[model samples]
Target chain A: MHTRAKLALSLTAVSTVLGLMIGVQYRQTSATAALGLGYLRGTVDTHTLTELKNLKASNQAAEQELTQLNDELNQFERVSSGSDKAMTAFQQRLTDERILAGITAVEGPGISVTLSDGASNGSDVEQILTHDWNVRSVINELFTAGAEAVSINGYRVVATSGVFCSGPVVRVNNHRLGAPFTIEAIGDPETLKSALDIQGGILDVLRMQGLNVTVPQIKQKIVMSAYTGSLPGSPTYSLNEAIPSLSNNGT
Target chain B: MIWLPILGLLIGAAVGLVSNWTIPVEYSSYLSIAILAALDTVFGGIRANLEKTFDDVVFLTGFFTNIFVAALLAFIGVQLGVDLYLAAVVAFGVRLFQNIAVIRRLVVTQIRAKRRRRFNTTS
Candidate 1:
């Protein structure tokens, strides 16, 4: 009887500790859930998580440096071009070129298209998941329909931007992106929507392939952020050299 | 009398919930493995008591040692780029099931013996 009492007492002690830890673990998981990172629970590779944090920090630093350099350049240009008609005209042309180069944030009427993976119910897994080609084709159709500016997952689509598959994720402007892909295009909303919505078009093809493709959502005003990635530092072809040959042709 | 241990478990859980204390996310795996080890030890203790083999020193020491050794193995596994924690998980999981099975059979036999005693006296 004494031994029985002792056994019960010891078991109770051990159980208490177990219950406490289980409670703590439950609370910790829910805390992560509150941060929207609950899905990462056991699936998150700590190595990659740390790497992502470091990369984000460096990217932020680079953006700040770029902004500072741009401000200095703009101040110099404003001071030098003051009270000079030719210089002001040149400045205006430079601004227009910057807009076209996608280095400047643009805002106008356009459409936003969202594409996501379909249900993976005992079918071709490849057909259900969104791929790089799907994103590229959508952007191409939008541009052909008069989209002046386009962006995928907030990464501005510049002339040199490459879209390709990177394992399970899609790489846009060398940044890995996952679904749902939000492609924002600044253009005539009605025209862009109609172009993508045409019968047997790219959107229809994707829908047929068991992908979730949103009919282009027309917005009265949508803002596309500037491309922050590095660009070519030096140009091999100079516009100054081409001007001389143009003048000769005119003569 | 059996409810005593269960009440203690509820009290501990309540204290943990109210405290709002938690370890870092990275250490959660280690903690979970440790919890599994503790549970295995607790069930093993119950089975030992039912079988007349319960030892206070062994039960208490086993509870702490199991938790510590399991967590240590997991930490080392992380450093060695191995899943050694899985070994702990499998070992403890199997033992936990065995202990529970023994405890269930012992309880059922005890209940049967009591019923038989009552029938014999009434007859």
Candidate 2:
């Protein structure tokens, strides 16, 4: 009886260790699994389901709309190709400028930029969330300003890296990363940094916003993986492109 | 992805804040112990919660079949980089499918065994 009881306890302890190890591995990879059931429980209401269904219908409708849009774009392209000589040159020049400023899609080995800033001080623990937009917005801005690739701390922002504020900590890829955020981006550091410091850039905006934004150009060769721009035809965003309102603002 | 993390954060914050404020200096040793215990408990909860959704082994299906959908998604956003939310959504969906597939196989096997037993008895 004593031996049997001891074995049972040992099994329990072993099971606990196995369970915890499974949990750690799961946390390291499928962080969403931990977070998924919660989201399904929370936001997946009948109303939300209906909205999603409607959105799906709209997206299907958009296929037709997209064909029409493509037709229109083709027409415009043809028209422009025929008559807008100077416009073409100007557009080419703009592309050149984007490339020059390091905002163009690039493939090479270079620096990776990781950005992190937690709410330094809040009246309560509610404020310390490391995933502050005050920080991520800056980090995303770093990318837009031609960061070759940026990871928040160690979490690689591969399509699935969750970047959001949780309490006072910011979760990157569901990994709770801390401050003194290290960002490594692969590119010409000089041009990339300039994109941020350029008049009315992200750094300038960050400085105005009163959050610290630092750019450390490294001497070590930064290796950037090739062709990491959004899939072709995906929406292209310029740094601070929305500064000029999408439509008339006064109205 | 958003909800669990948010809930965890709120609860964690509550635990962290509550302990700091309520733990008295006279019981400082107890306070430290309590904090450690509370943290471990929450950590365990988070782990259990995750296992419900993601199976880490899915990444190793030999043919990448397990993570194929996720890889496709990652590929789609490779240009602008992958969207974190989309990755989470895809990963969760794939994992759910994996779990369901397991259950389906198990149920089918059980039904086949019962059928075989019935056949044997009838014969």
Candidate 3:
């Protein structure tokens, strides 16, 4: 074949192959993405279930302890009443319980900043999942905003809960989260908003990443759990009596 | 054409089926092309180095695309009220079949062309 003819044939071949390759690449990537997302989504669902289950278990345990403490206090008060400072310990325990159970959705004033995917400029089908500025970054910002506690998608943030990615999905305390990450906080809403919207603040960071952010107040409630960790129960979570199962597995 | 991406998808599915049958995986998840590259080199399946490039592309596609499909599945699966994993498996299977069929046709066409070319020159 002549040079031009050969070039044309080669070009045609390359073009056809690349075209075909790219098409399948996109579809397969999308499918694989779906699979990963599905797995991650399942992980999130599992985490949510775990969260609820463990929290419930903790609540029950805490409640039992609180009831016992309260009974002891009633007896102590009836027996003697001069100075019941000893009850302070009991009261603190109950407070900790409420905070840990995530029943304490703080409501005074707070801010909500939304971070969208940074890849908006790219094609919708472009293979991108976790942006550099992810949910954890936002969570950090809220903490900086003097957020007493925070929650995303009803899953409360606790001291122990870590934020990171698990296969294209951001996990908080092992809870898989999708986009439009809702962050609830308990603080002075205006002040919090001010800190976030300042010239060189969280909003700026969000914009740099090409993510959309909006700060709003929780006119009603912001239930931020003190923590969302494992507890004794389920096939996965077993904080208290987890050793028995582990031992059984070994056996 | 727009169908190009579709063709790539089919090729990926072919990779999945071929790898699934020949390659042993406990979880059934694909080996990334990076890993497959090594496996191919180690086993030295004839012309595997060249083939690994293709498998790697397909494997990467499979890994990455699953995430997107998972998100969509979760969003839509809410309507059906089934668990997300089940929904995802169904979606993955459908994509697999679609991918396999397209690549099979492409390969057959290549073979037919080659045969016709040989016969014509001889005649």
For DockQ, the strongest prediction is: 1
**Model 1: TM-score, first chain:** 0.58
For candidate 3, write residues A104-217 as lDDT tens digits: 444445666566565555545332344534667767777777776678776777766667766767777787887767777766777667766788776676666566666554
True contacts kept of 3: 0.00
The residue pairs found clashing in candidate 1 are: none
Which DockQ value does candidate 2 get?
0.01
Interface RMSD of each: 0.8, 14.8, 11.1
lDDT of 2 by residue, A114-233 (tens): 333434554443333333665566566666766545555644454434467676567765667667676666556776666655788765665454444565555356433222234223
Error of 1 at A191 (Å): 42
Instruction: lDDT for model 2, please.
Output: 0.47
Query: Which candidate ranks first by lDDT, i.e. highest?
Result: 1
State the displacement of the C-alpha of residue A204, model 2, in Å, after optimal TM-score superposition: 15
Candidate 2 TM-score versus the reference:
0.28
Error of 2 at A140 (Å): 7.4
Q: State which candidate, 2 or 3, has the greater TM-score.
A: 3
TM-score of chain A by itself in each prediction: 0.58, 0.38, 0.50
Count backbone overlaps in model 2.
Answer: 35
**Per-residue accuracy of model 1 over B58-97 as CA lDDT, tens digit each:** 9999999999999999999999999999999999999999
The segments of candidate 2 whose C-alpha lies over 4 angstroms from its true place after superposition are: A1-53, A83-134, A137-163, A167-169, A172-180, A185-215, A218-251, B1-123
